[model samples]
Target: MSDYDYVIVGAGAAGCVLAYRLSQDPANRVLLIEAGGGDGHPFIHMPKGLGKILFNPRFLWPFMTEPEAVSNDTGESWARGRVLGGSSAVNGMVWVHGEAANYDRLAELAGADWSWTHIRQAYCELEGHQLGDGPARGGKGPLRISLSDYRSRLTEAMVAAGVAMGLKRAEDVNDPEDGERVGYAPRTIWRGRRQSAATAFLRPARRRPNLTIVTGVTVDRVAVENGRTTGVEGRKDGAAARYTAAKEVLLCAGTIASPAILQRSGIGPAASLRSLGIPVVRDLPAVGANLREHRGIVMQWKVDDRLSQNRDYRGVGLVRSVLRYFAQHKGPMAGGAYDMGAWFKTRPELPIPDGQLLMSPYSFDYGAPSLRVEPSGGFNICVYKLRPDSQGSILIRSRDPADPPVIHARYASDESDRASIPVLVRYARRYVAQAPLRDMVIAETRPGPEFETDAQIFEAYRRFGYGNYHACGTCRMGSDEDAVVDGALNVRGVQGLRVVDASVFPFMLAGNTQAPVMAIAWRAADIVLRESR
Candidate 1:
């Protein structure tokens, strides 16, 4: 006898979507387990309250990467949401579905089902866009996608600057036809609240009698018998608990936790498993390999105090902003992380946009212990190489489920990645020095004009560069021999087990990952349904 038809680990963006879709059929008993608690915090709903929610221990799983040569021997804090919606609840509400070409490449590696055509259709079914229905955009769906209602003169000037530099002014940043364009960013914020996966997908699913949501349960490992996952074993309320899955066990625990969970279950590299004194269930070396993240550097410029939103974030201004939010849900309190976004090629010779930029009207002191808004008026721009070839790994330190995984984010390790630092820095400088932005001119606050040469700029990046928190590819899916999961998202050497979520991505997408993760889950549900029949 089984406790559920399907057992889902982690209630993040992917897990929420899976729970909802799988439970749509009343006959399927689905159990969704989360290590974190509920998403009832007011900060989780308030769009601009990300700063408050991100560092809150109750809602976050703060994992730090091991120090590497490229990052000046300093560990970087890699935080993911520990709450119901996972990172989607704590993330900067940016909504982007990357380029169609990226999905086309996945189709090449995986199968036709993972192609752009299918993924686009899944997106159309997932979104509820405020811009209304279109051939490409969805209008009536669960996830509400909307443009940020908040605007700033500085952000408008940044878009103008991009247009003057020959970049297309995009109406929809996610539109595939808008190549090399700049525009106000689209976000997973509807009305005034953050439309996280918990809010959009799981809320409705919670009403289903067949769906069971168990939180604050720490999953130890999958209970496998004779190479087939029968269920999952974990600790709940300090007591041992086990749940069985008659159909399948789905691991949607994001990139870090999914791989860690597999390794703990003796499903990773044979050598490592032996060293950890755990009998190897499968000798899958790629279980925790190929970790990828977007590395970017921030450039801040001191602008006129009136043009920046710095004041709205501090002291009395913050109090007023709070009141305004409750009264009308309008103001900085309703804004997303970035005001504007752009995709561009560093060099004209490149066929696709190789770089991405995000602009915010407010600046933060990056070196602060926690994210602290600057007292002075300023704006910041973050520039990143859309895709880098550098790879890393995640390994378990101990068998204890409470222990955090060892993360090795080998940023800027590749020659090309290192070379792009100078190119990106120089490009950002040039972009800000153009048109109307030049008139609103100010001095570069961090890594200023003194860092003119390529070497100097590269050094500046080493000091200030940070991961964009878009980590993936640890449990990569492919048709290759060493791939952890196959084209249909099934574990290579196991039965009744699947690894969904960003962990299965063979490569990282060029933009924010939330949208793609949701789409992947939506498509995976169809695969699971077809296979179950």
Candidate 2:
């Protein structure tokens, strides 16, 4: 039996950081296990090259949800990172650090110190903005942030369009500490490589003798005795084994896998655990109850000009582009297709922004078996409802570790979420139909005017929309009986076991969760360090 001061499950964004920070003391021994293999691919390092690995089963979890009834949408399949860096290795690399109100609300919902003022300090510490550093904007950190390197005449035109729409030009949206509406997204890219969690936190800590990283090991369950976590049991290289944690077991397995792991370990709803014949250690009904995720539909438009990346990503050109990226990182492949976007308050009077608009130079159809090409260069708009009211759950279907969990993402179940989405979609359509975008585009590829009316819009949302891969809130944080974890993120029913990933968020934040999740992990590290000391 192997023992350590700390064993962190899942070396994703949260796990990687946790392992790195906790092991910083040098005297403390930490073991980091990742279900996925090494982050050896070239695309994994290239910021813009994430598109190359989006659907690869080797790099993604490829989880699908159960069918939903209300919205006519059947179900959605989510792609989560199965690599060393987790989703950060394969994300758009957009570095929007969530709105101020997002943290403010989380603080209010969870407790004190989690407030915006406290959380913002942590955010500033973890991130290093490349565009420009300020009191609330930038500092010396591992994750490098900068504006999109690949700029075109089109990007300027896009800014013009936003101006025409009565939107203010944000100097820098990635500056969360400033609490202002900054424009031009600051991408999570460093030098030329993708600044994933592995690159930022894990790699540096890997040299430490106290930290051991085991890849391709899937942790099935947390070993518990008398309602306290003892260790963990799982398989590796076709052989099963178990390890005991001498100190604590940190579930950094993310929102989806963390809850599922807890359930398989018999720490969830008694009724559900009884069905699986797994002895219920903790009858925590909130294990997977407060599931929340950001969902969005990609709106495509065809353009008359062939100047977009859409024209660049086809046939022989793609091969050449890949070679160019490998040889040197200064090509189109070095940049996220999304060079520009906006965070806006849908209703003018809201205290915080309601939605985020992701702008790309090319259209993307998730349903396409293979990547399709637009005859001419075109633009794609991805509008996401930031503060969704919908909820979902992850349930264990069987005791088997290989079996996929039952994901029922009850999206659009909330009337508010259902109502708010159409408004964003309509706005996206209208924005593209006017001024600079309208002059460049020919027609809308999705929802195509035929899908007008509230019924049709909602139906289309159900049929086509998918998770932003930002699923969170399972094994949520709070102090109530229903909360799986407390304000300190300790699992309520179990001692010496805490969930420190996006799963701890009491509710979903208002943007791409990567940055905010990092901040939470950073704060979590301080908590763990303080307690351990």
TM-score, each model?
0.98, 0.95
What is the TM-score (0 to 1) of candidate 2? 0.95
Query: What is the model-wide C-alpha lDDT for candidate 1?
Result: 0.90
lDDT of each: 0.90, 0.79
Give every collision pair in model 2.
Answer: 73-462, 73-463, 130-145, 170-182, 170-183, 171-183
Candidate of highest TM-score: 1
Candidate 2 per-residue C-alpha lDDT over 366-459 given as tens digits, one digit per residue, 9 for 90 to 100:
4567766565667777788876788888898999888888998888788889788778888787677657757777677776788888888877
Task: Please write out the lDDT profile of model 1 over residues 173-208, one tens digit for every residue.
Answer: 888762789999999998889999999999989999
Runs with alpha carbons beyond 4 Å of true place in candidate 2: 70-73, 177-182, 365-368
- CA RMSD per model (angstroms): 1.2, 2.1
